[model samples]
Target: MVITVPATVPIESFQRLRIETYTDVAAAALLVYDYLLTFNVEKSLIWPSRWNIMKVLFLLTRYLPFVDVTLVLFYQLKTNISVETCRATYFPAGWFIVLGIMVAEIILTIRTWAIWGRSKRIGIILGVSALVAIIPTLYIEKVFLDSLVFSPYPSPATPGCLLTAGNPIIAASFVIVILFETLVLTLTLIKGVQHYRIASGRGFVSVLYRDGVVFYIYLFGISVVNLIVIVAAPRDLANLLAIFQRVMHSLLSARVLMNLREANQREYALAGMQSSPLQHLSFSQSRSSEEDRLSFRRNLDGTVIDIS
Candidate 1:
């Protein structure tokens, strides 16, 4: 069955679907991150000290949920809701929703880095950058909108609705942000690798650090590496708009699952030690030492009798 959006949508059309959906995703990401922090996922992999990193991610992503949701609402309003942009005939135009998804992707990427690499400093930096960058985007987008003649959704395709500067300044700002993110991701990879080497040095100590870093490095190698290409991503290149968010969602979920499994495995190991091997060792050593004491006591008694 084919779905179709209406040709004439109310002003709040963008706010309805895109913003609401993006909010759902971003809010969920923030919630999962909080749950992980509350559960001490970082402490499981690194130390309790690392919980601060996850805490920062949770807070920052919580802020970003609004960014995505607001933009999604903006897009639905801006969108014609015609067959051109909305994926279906009567529903949302996916192409134009790229703007909202891009915001979402960047936010999600921040959480992903914090989770995998234990990155607090980077999260703080990115959060600040995003705040500053939004000022310019808002000013630029608004001024550009003012010069337009027709209200959006005046007709099918909405192609002639208005003329807006696909502002290069706004585009350049995102590129700079992406470049900053790339740098942060690179630093995380280096740290994770260093931690991995340290963990390997500990003789029989199970994969506390080694596995943590391995997962981080794997995420970087697989997803972060691809993101480097997007640092120079073009403004009108609408196709790449959704690329970052969709990719981060997949990678973030994967790492979270792996970290959860490792934590459970560690708990099982600790539990097994408490129940079996540790108990046996304590019992055997106690029995052996008691027997030796009894023998020595008998020997002392014999010596005293001989002296008598």
Candidate 2:
């Protein structure tokens, strides 16, 4: 009896797979490091805080990536994985990435809505826009996953799954993401400018705006790069940035929530130190209507603050 062994993958293909594996490993490692760095903040500011919708969303955005990243690392690092196993694992991994991004976007949407005084009109608009962007993007993602062409492992020793072709239509999902982010950023900037003009100090509102803008910039750049890689790169090299972008969505969105909570804690502490009724009166009088609407007030436990 004669047996055949598959030929080794070409050097170029092996190199690309190596690079992709490195990216997956980097993303997983970064998430762990970030979790450690922020664990103290989470304990102090988040764990003790009253549970609200924002808190729930923050927790979801903060920790859900562990599951997604684990799946990704498995898919990328498991040697001798079958093509059937790859097909079964890959879509779930993709869905996890999408779910992570969607949850983070929800957190940002709520933040934007809060900065805008939680106006019902603005909330309605954001909600509608999110639905519009999300539903189609999800459908496109399903189509993209369905269109993937996975090849047999180039060699028995080849690490991880191999994709020989993919639908560039996946690029459309990133385009939608970029467009939605633009809208969110525009709203944030307009409110930020208003806050800058009226607010006298770097208060909670300032922290919210600053973080929102910075987060937008980083996520926007990543989304663009992901789109470009999908559209222009070879199928083997496509999706190189997908996991990184999802990790950023989780990491940055978590930061935005934590920073806002921390700023609220500081302002609450500072306000408590002031004893003069006259000073309070003067400060209240000086605030514009918009500033008043954006004011932060702490809960009885002093662990949570909300823009009222």
TM-score of each: 0.39, 0.88
| C-alpha RMSD (angstroms) for model 1 | 17.0
lDDT of 1 at 259: 45
Minimal lDDT window, size 10, model 2: 298-307
lDDT of 1 by residue, 239-270 (tens): 13333343343334334433434544554565
Model 2's number of clashes is: 0
**Model 1 TM-score, all chains together:** 0.39
**Off by more than 4 A, model 2:** 1-9, 276-286, 289-308
Which residue ranges in model 1 land beyond 4 Å of their true spot? 1-151, 154-163, 201-275, 278-308
| Residue 181 C-alpha lDDT in model 1 | 46
Report the Cα RMSD per candidate.
17.0, 5.2
